[model samples]
Target: MNRLPYATVARCVSSLSRTGLYQGVDLRVLEAFDLDALAHFSGMQPGALCAGACVASQSSPALALTSANLRWCPACMAEGLHAALFQFSPITRCPTHNAPLIQACPHCGKTIPYRLDPAAVATPLACPTCMSPLVADLTILAHAHHIVGP
Candidate 1:
């Protein structure tokens, strides 16, 4: 959506507000998506995307819910995908060490450590160690229920 009209963005904000989600998100937050800024704003590394953020615009109707430019945060998405995955919004610290974690290749199964400055977003995810489907495409319908099942 190239420069979505103010009305559209407002509608989305209104909807989110009514749902009691993203109540404090400033309108400027949605404005960042104008130039594929979700990648940068989300602080996600290149290539890899967490499951929740993994669902692309073409993958599911869930994205239709946000003005997020169809870009999802893997960490946030993981939480939505599976409650046990992670516990943080805009996760700035490494869930493991409480330090910082970077995106890695799930295929290579290597931890591509990152600093997560919390001040910077849009980090690349190519592993200097190996290749992996970092952002493995998945449909929301497939994961609409439970990633690990009760």
Candidate 2:
């Protein structure tokens, strides 16, 4: 994806330099993947994701359907995979594996922002603060999900 277009980045997600967090691509990006079909593959209930888990716009609803933090499943990360379903606030645990959604590095308790930057893509499975290995399997599919600077 070296020739990845700038328009796509401008449309999908935004890397926040000031806050060091990110506004991930629209949850609608997964719409084409069909939440129901994805849940079927993930061994979860389709309705769990049908609650209109839209990110908060003006904060009218006290409980936003989704969260900004990248809560992860230990089971999936152990296999070097990330499930987008973990982004929903309704998903407290991985239904398939029954593992809790983790928001911080267990070893250091440092919260990893749900960022979409090069460092995160470059070291996809390592805790930035403590350099802890988050992925036990470390597959190629887990590395550099984004284009990096030379």
Candidate 3:
């Protein structure tokens, strides 16, 4: 994968990297990319996708995010989604699905950190260790399009 300016550019809600010691996306850098490009790559609206996260807009908090580990919502994952707010240190719950954010995989009980390489992002919504799904079927994911909606 191309090395983005700051780091891995997690497209929508469900993908990250495979290798090279890089981690999560830096929104300031990502904001530079065309929203159409991002949506074309990830099948989501860039603004709606990141609505839960803090970013570089003068009105928003300045990059107050936690990217070292993967903390997510199972209910949202069940529908094949991950919210950017999960990366916010202050957010311990999923306001959309009303589920607590979790760091460990339910299948293998392993903590899956964000990765941004080809292989990992290729199977973005799966557990790297157990090869189990981090989200439910991708088909189900389509039905949950309202996930990032206002």
In order of listing, the candidates' clash counts read 6, 0, 6
Candidate 3 regions off by >4 Å? Answer: 1-36, 39-64, 142-150
Model 2, 1-150: lDDT tens per residue?
Answer: 112222333333332342332333343233322444445444456565444343333343633565666678887776555665687678899988998889888889987765444455545567878878787655433244433343
Candidate 3 clashes between residue pairs 3 or more apart in a chain or in different chains: 16-115, 16-116, 17-115, 17-116, 17-117, 18-117
What local lDDT does model 3 show for residue 95? Answer: 93
Candidate 3 minimal-lDDT segment of 10 residues: 1-10
Displacement of the residue 46 alpha carbon in candidate 1, Å? 24
lDDT digits (tens) for residues 5-86 of candidate 3 = 1123444323333332244344332343455655565556767645544464424455544554677888877755566668
For each candidate, the alpha-carbon lDDT, in order, equals: 0.33, 0.55, 0.57
Order of all candidates by lDDT, from best down to worst?
A: 3, 2, 1
Top TM-score prediction, candidate number: 3
lDDT score, candidate 1, position 146: 42
> What are the C-alpha RMSDs, in order, of all predicted structures?
15.8, 8.9, 7.7
Model 2, residue 5: distance off in Å is 15
TM-score: model 2 vs. ground truth: 0.52
Better of 1 and 2 by TM-score: 2
Candidates in order, TM-scores: namely 0.20, 0.52, 0.58
